[model samples]
Target chain A: MKTVKEGEIRRREILDVARELFVTKGYDHTSVNDILKIVDIAKGTFYYYFASKEEVLEAIILDIVEEGARRAEIIVKDQSIPLLNRIMMAIMAQTPEFEGSEEIKEELHKVENAKLERLYLKAMLKRMTPVLQEPVLECIKEGIAHMEYPTECIETILLLGHMMFDCDTFEWKMEEYPQKIQAFLCHAERMLGTKEGELSGFLQMFGQMP
Target chain B: MKTVKEGEIRRREILDVARELFVTKGYDHTSVNDILKIVDIAKGTFYYYFASKEEVLEAIILDIVEEGARRAEIIVKDQSIPLLNRIMMAIMAQTPEFEGSEEIKEELHKVENAKLERLYLKAMLKRMTPVLQEPVLECIKEGIAHMEYPTECIETILLLGHMMFDCDTFEWKMEEYPQKIQAFLCHAERMLGTKEGELSGFLQMFGQMP
Candidate 1:
């Protein structure tokens, strides 16, 4: 039997090969056999790591979620940055980016892979909520002492941000995009009890103002 | 060829039969042949109305969307009700109820039908936004003369309400439900420029309070 470390290495190899294939070729077009061929692994070995191609995709999604959570946690803990900016950065960090892989991002946007896209968003939100919640509560405590906000507002804000901004969830016209962003900032300020334009700096971060 | 009225009647007949089947037998379990056999129509007749079973579902969804928009329009146009209450009613009207058909709602909740659920939510939001937008804009104009909220906020608020409250989108636990509703109400108050307890009457409408 292979050692535990060796088995772990084999699994990582399979995932890396499958992720590349999924990005280069669409998820619907990528096959387990193709992954096995690229990784030089037997069918048994592929099955040993993942039951099917869908599971491989799920694994990749989980990797992205974990990475995002890691980034958000670090941002949340950083005290040098202003609290509101850190909170903004922490929330923004939850959005999963494929790093240098724009092709994978484009592939996920295709109609056929919509279900996969939904699954990824749901998974990322589920994992990142708790990581970002503490900082959100801290901001509320520090920024809005007079207001009695419920703890559940953190999740509500996160869900609103995700649904409003995610292209897959709510498709706004190109012309309407800036207006929507401005409204989001206004609502965000109201919800977080920040003064108007306190979060305007965030607009500069995006290099656009509405 | 059938007259235009007869064709429309025939199409409704098929949809009614398929909708009953989808609710009772579940969308995945109900086949095109099942619908054909129950409607007492030939395959060609069924296909004449809908391209496939999926198309039939889409038609059912559209019917629900149109019905919701109609109800919301009536609520928005009622001059007797207060503006905020009308706005709340208009937004709530967008949620599609099967009208004594809880089975269909439960069916849509099943894991296998998540894609259908997503499609339904997307269609409902897209159709309802324009219908509800006018009333929302009116409410913002009448209620918040001091504040300059963006017009795009109508869609953002609707999207936030749907995502936060929809069981499919965010699964709040039984105990967490009350807290979530309170948070939503607070945020809604802030966004609409209403006083804290001005919208508390909304909780009474639901027969519960946080």
Candidate 2:
């Protein structure tokens, strides 16, 4: 058990170092050698943790998806929060972490690195969707139960919710974040046959994002 | 002038045959030599028209973008059609062509070719957006002139319209074509401050696609 714990800690340490390098230097510019040097790990030890740079990228994306799932799970289980608010919280959970990471912004926006960023984002969304689906569906069920949404078009509404929740992946501007969320919530209310202002509380909460 | 015309025709013939082969075989599987043989062109002739297979792919994407822009121009210029219908027509133009091409489906879905398809689609959208922007702006102007839309939110609404118009690139299902369009149009009407049922006629026409 001690050996297993040590191995896990070592793996996370490598990831932490790699993420720092990737954010500061950009993914393409940061070589495996750079990460190994930063972590001061032997070549074999580095290989033991991650097979290649692409695997490191996949690991980073997996970490993001896991975090999203974890947050979503917490929000869904919190019975005190309204269902719409819970759903909004689950979807909006990613933005704060992203906004907190100021170091990644310049690297992400570098013209030459845009494709790599898009590729990773696309991969992240594909992996994240399946993990978040359950919480999203539960929220939808609660919305239906509360008569806040119609029951007839569950599948379509679920699909639409997935797309709307993935607006970050859809490349919607962060500058227009409030308007986009408001517009999306208004449309979702229309689609689910709810009253116009039924989901306004969630929008009000989203507007307070720092 | 006659020599230029002949050169244009020859270039198009090469593109036509190459497109057929690309649709039938995968892009990676279809070599330049294969295209040359099929078109009965000398190696020098092939090189004269295109530097590489990548260039051919770029040319094909350019063709698609040009066609979209051309259709957008026609729809926007036609004063007889209602402005809402013109906007709907511009968005709908690409779907039928995409749906009708059964051969391209296999190539597009191939795992090895997915990256190439994505790269080309990204390039096509980049080129297509500016071209379509004019017609889209005109539609919004007409909407505002008729007091169907608010003038203050023109920029945001324009951005939203571009997103809505790129639904083909968004990969919304042809299976959910009618529902997607109706839901989209209804939401668009709300966003643009138009009366309910104003855009329903376009949805009726879209449902007749066969």
Candidate 3:
């Protein structure tokens, strides 16, 4: 039998290979056999790590969520940054970029992979809600922001933010995209108790307007 | 050869039967054959009316959306009601209740029917966005609310409101449901530029908090 460390390494290798294939060739196009071909692992070995392709997709999403949580935790704990900037940074950290992320995102937008898209968003919100709550509550306590139901508000904001701003969640027209981002910033400023135009700078982070 | 009127009537009949079966027996359990048996129509007749069960679902959703738009149009045109109340009424009109709506909602919440839930929400937003825009813009013009991107804000609010409040969109625990509604109200007041607690009275419309 393989040692525990060796088994762990094998699982990591399989996940990496699967993610690469999913991004490069698309999730629907990629298969367990393709993963096994790249990882040079037997079908039994692959099944030992993941029960099915869907499970592997879930595993990939979990890894992204954990990485985001870790980054957000660090940002929350840092005191040198301003409260608003730290909060924004922490929020952006939740969308950590990996190689070929854009291609993977394109794949997720297809109709056949919508369930996976939903799964990814749901998983991100579930995992990041708690991690981002710390900085948000701190902002409230510092009088930088005020909310009656801070915890619930945080969760609502995250859910709305994801649903509105995430391209995978909606099929926005090319011109409509920039307007949606702008509107999100405007509402976010109000929701966070920030002054008008305070959050406008973050629009650049969303990319250039058409 | 059937007359145009007869064809339209037969189409409506098929849709009505399909919707009933979908709600009562659950969408997954219902089939085209089941619908045909209830409607007492031949297979060819059913096909002539609806290409597939999924098309019938689209027709049902379209019917609901059109009904909502019609109601909202009337509410928006009613100057007798106060502006705020009219706006609220118009927004509420988008969720027009039909017989067995609660049951249909329950059916949509099932994991197997998530795609239907998403499709329904998307259809509602697409149709209701324009209908609701008139009242929202009126609020901005009357100085009752302020928004930088009024049209975009309305769409974002509707999209967020649906995703956050609609039980089909997320699986909130019993306790979490009320908190989310409360949070939404707080955020809505801020986003709408209403005074704090101004929108609190509308929470009753969401049903009693458990």
Best by lDDT: 3
lDDT scores in order: 0.73, 0.57, 0.75
Which candidate model has the greater TM-score, 1 or 3?
1
Q: Residue B118 lDDT in model 3? A: 71
Per-candidate DockQ values are 0.51, 0.13, 0.52
lDDT of 3 by residue, B171-209 (tens): 678777776777777887788786688777778877643
Report how far residue A209 has shifted in candidate 2, in Å: 17
Which 10 consecutive positions of candidate 3 chain B have the poorest summed lDDT? B103-112
TM-score of chain B of each: 0.86, 0.65, 0.85
Docking class of 1: medium
Task: Kindly report the docking quality category of candidate 3.
Answer: medium
lDDT of 1 at B99: 84
- The prediction achieving the highest TM-score against the true structure is 1
Off by over 4 Å in 1: A144-147, A207-210, B144-147, B207-210
Runs in model 2 lying further than 4 Å from the true structure: A1-8, A23-26, A33-51, A61-210, B1-10, B42-45, B74-81, B96-182, B200-210
Q: What is the TM-score of each candidate against the true structure?
A: 0.89, 0.58, 0.88
Error of 1 at A145 (Å): 7.3
